[model samples]
Target: MSMPQPERLHLDSDAATGYPNSPLPVLVYRQVLDISNAEERADAFESMFKRHGWPPAWRYHLYDFDHFHSTAHEALGIFRGQARARLGGPNGQELMLYPGDVLVLPAGVGHASLEADDDFCMVGAYPPDQKPEIERGDPAQLAAAKARVAAVALPEDSPAGGSLAELWREDS
Candidate 1:
């Protein structure tokens, strides 16, 4: 079966909070995996990431408050339950994500879980050999974070599957 294409969204910086959301568009791929079992879904996601040369995939629940990663881009594959998450920044959009949903967050994009089912969980990954630095809407880190976000390179492909280079290369 062919993979479903992802929906792309580009978010701008939060002027009021100085949240440096990413210039690269966020990619949301819905129902990419057909598995219903959480463990099976997680394993599939990990394998896909590994195939794409992304490493150190981890499984966890999302944080409740808004936060951004300044050092590296991240990808999350929903393995169980459902979640309502806010992305971009404080004033950004809210998205309802379910099992089999995948989100590719560019570096410096803010994300937080507003609500979720008790069993909500996801598998997260980063580009090969890169580490993520968590920043929680810090005013002091705004300038440097924005600079780092601006300088960060795009990933070669979507964590879910398929080329993301073209989508990310477009001017936002």
Candidate 2:
């Protein structure tokens, strides 16, 4: 059988928190990820979500082609440059992603990224189930994730607005 797509949730901006938040009656664990190229991986992300029961999310990403990285459920990161992120922390951790690298934050995990790159591309993910508490990678990986964890907007801004956030917030 094909790999299942993730479930999509609705979202709203936590004007209070700056980070996007899930709507009431929804869960807050979104995912983040990356594959290779922007358009190609975006297509894959779309299909991946649909295959798993997520709403069509690709449309929310059309405007983010430069230094792009998303903060949501399991993420897909195809780095054109360096990037940073937390394994799971506030603002996530700080790390970096290198060119031609693909980072997959598969399924439900509290995560986010910072762009420490020359230029990069990535997509966020949100698996319906809670993620396993995997051990943090060694210093090398930690360093990388930190670089990938730049402030969400400085890199590419929120590609998905209220509507997309609303869709993502359903289970958050």
Candidate closest to the true structure, highest lDDT:
1
**Per-residue CA lDDT of candidate 2, range 1-172, in tens?**
3222233323332222233222222222222334556566556655555454333432321111112122233334242444565333243333444432323332222344443444445444433332223232233343333333322212111122123334333344
Would you estimate the TM-scores of all the predictions?
0.94, 0.32
**C-alpha RMSD for every candidate:** 1.4, 14.1
The clash count for each model shown is: 0, 73
For candidate 2, the lDDT comes to 0.34
Error of 1 at 120 (Å): 0.2
Candidate 1, position 66, lDDT: 90
Cα miss at 43, model 2 (Å)?
Answer: 1.6
Each model's lDDT? 0.85, 0.34
Q: How much is 47 displaced in model 2, in angstroms? A: 1.7
